[model samples]
Target: MKLYDHSVTVSSKRLNLFLKEIGVTDIERVEVNVREGGNLAQSYQDKSVNGKVPLLELDDGTYLSETVAISRYFDEITPNDLNLFGASTLERAKVEMWNRIVEIDGIQNAFQAFRNLSGIYADRENCVEAWGEEAKHRVELFLPKLDKQLGQSKYVATDNYTIADISAYIFVFVAVNALKVDVFETSQNIKRWFDDVSSRPALQN
Candidate 1:
C-alpha cells in the first residue's frame, strides 16, 4: 500500500498519527506536494479525481481518498489491533459523531479563516474576506462550548483516546496557528486537554 502524503496538510498529519497509534508501519509513503501543484498533475489526478493528499493505494489498484475513510480502512484491516474508531458499537458512534462535529464546526471554519484572511489559496479558489471573518468568528464562538465539553470528559468520545481527539486536536492546532485564535490562552479546559493529549507519544511521532 502507498500513502500519497502531504507533510503539512491536516489529513496527512491525522493519518500518520493514526498509523503510529495502530502500530501499522508496512504501508509506504509517496509525497505529493500540493503547494507545488503536484496533485494537479494529470497522472496523479487521473487516479485521485479530488486531487487530495492522504490518499491510499490498495494492493489491487484501488485508490482510496479522504482521511477518515482511509484511516477506517486501515483500522478495519487490523481488527486484532487497537481500534482508534472505538471498541464497541455505541462507542464507535460516539467517536464518529464527535469527529464529524469537530470537522464541521472547528476545522472547517479554521481553514475558511486561513484561506480567506491569509489569501494563501486565493489563486486556487475564491477568498471572500467577509465570509472569512465570519468563519473565524464562528469558530471563536464554538471554542467555549468545546472547552465546556472537555472540562467534563478526559477524552472527546470515550474514556479512552479515540479519533475524535485527533480531529479536535487538529482543530485546536489550526485555531492557534492558522486562524490565529487564542485557544490555549483563553480556554483553560482546552489547554489542559491539549496538554494531556500532547503528552501522548503518538502525537510526537
Candidate 2:
C-alpha cells in the first residue's frame, strides 16, 4: 500500500499520527506538495476526486480518501491490534460521537479560520476575513466544552487513547499554530490532556 501524503496539512498529520500509533510502518509514502498544486494536478485528481492529500492506495489499486475513512480502514484491517476505534458497541458509539464533535466543533472551525486568515492557502482557495474571524470565535467558544469533556476522561472517548484523541490533538495543533491562540492558558484540562498526548512516542515523530 502507498499513502499520498502532505506533512503540513492537519488532516494528513492526523492520519500519519494514527498510522504511527497503530505501528504501521511497512507502507510506502508518496509526498504531495499542495503548495505546488500537486494535489490539484490531473493525475492526483484522477486518483482522488476531491484532489486532497493523504490518499491511500491499496495493493489492488483501490484508492481511499478522507482521514476518518482511512483510519477506519486501518482499524478494520487490524481489528485486534490497538483498538483505536473501540472494542465494544458502546465504546464505538462514544468514540464516534467524540470524533464527530472534535471534527465539527474543533478541527473544521480551526481549519476554516486558518484557510481564511493565512496567506499560505491564498492560492488554493479564496480567503475571507469575516469568515476567518467567525471560525476563530467558534473555536474559542467550543474550547471550554472540549475541556470539560477531557476533564471527565483520561482520553477523549474512553480510558484508552483512541482516534478521537488524535482528532482533538490535530485541532489543538492548528489552534495554536494557525489561529495563534493560547489554548493552554484557557483550559487546564486540555493542557493536561495535550501534554500527555504530545509525550507519546508516536506523536514525537
Candidate 3:
C-alpha cells in the first residue's frame, strides 16, 4: 500500500498517529506538498477526486480517502493490543458517536474558522470572514458538552483510548493554540482529558 501524505495537515497527523499506535510500518509514503498545490493538481486528483491528502492506494490500485476510514482500515488489518476503534459492538458504536462529534463540531469548525478567517485557501475557495468568525465561536460551544461527557466517562468515547480521543486530541491543538478559543481553561474536565490523552507516546511523533 502507498499513502499520499500532506505531512503537516491534521488528517495526516491523525492517520500517522493511528499507524504509529498500531505499529504498521510497511506502507510506502509519498509526500504531496499541498501548500504548493500538489494535491490540487489533476494528476493527483485522478486517484481520489476528493483531492485530500493521506490518500491510500491499496495493493490492487484501490484508492481510499478520509483519515478515519483509512485509520479504521489499518486498525482492522493490524492485530495488536492497541485496538483504537474499540473491543466490541457497543464500544464501536460509542466510538463512532464521539468521533463524529469531534470531527464535525470540533475539527470541521476549526477548518472553517482557520481557512476563512486567515484566508489561507482564498486562492482555491471563497473565504467568508463572517462564517469564519461564527465557526470560531462555534468551536467553544462543543467544549462544554465534551467537558460534561468527560466528567462522567474516563475517556472521550469509551474507557480505552479510542479514535474519538485521537480526533479530540487533534482538535484541542486547533481550539487552544491555532484558533485561540481557549475555553478549556474554564472547562476542567476536557482540559484534564486533553492533557492526559495528549501525553501519549504516539502523539509525540
RMSD of each: 1.4, 1.2, 1.1
**Inter-residue clash pairs, candidate 1:** none
Global lDDT of model 2: 0.90
Q: TM-scores for all candidates?
A: 0.94, 0.95, 0.96
Give the Cα lDDT of each candidate: 0.86, 0.90, 0.87
Worst 10 residues of 3 by lDDT: 176-185
Writing each residue's lDDT as its tens digit, candidate 3 over 1-205 gives: 8999977887788889888888887888999988778888888899985887889999998999899989988888888887688789999889999999889999999889998999987778899999999999888788888889999998999888898998888888778777988667788998888788878888775
State which candidate has the highest lDDT: 2
Q: Higher TM-score: candidate 1 or 3?
A: 3
Alpha carbon lDDT of residue 204, candidate 2?
A: 79
Model 2, range 1-205, lDDT digits (tens) per residue?
8999988877888998998888777888999998788888888999995788889999999999999999999878863567799779999899999999999999989988988877567887889999999999999999999999889999999988999999999999999987989899999999999999999999875
Question: lDDT, candidate 1, residue 65?
Answer: 89
Clashing pairs in 2: none
Write the residue-wise lDDT of candidate 1 on 92-120 in tens digits. 89888889988899888988888899987
Judge candidate 1 against the unseen true structure and give its global Cα lDDT, from 0 to 1: 0.86
lDDT at 124, model 3: 86
**Clashing residue pairs in candidate 3, if any?**
none
Ranking by TM-score: 3, 2, 1
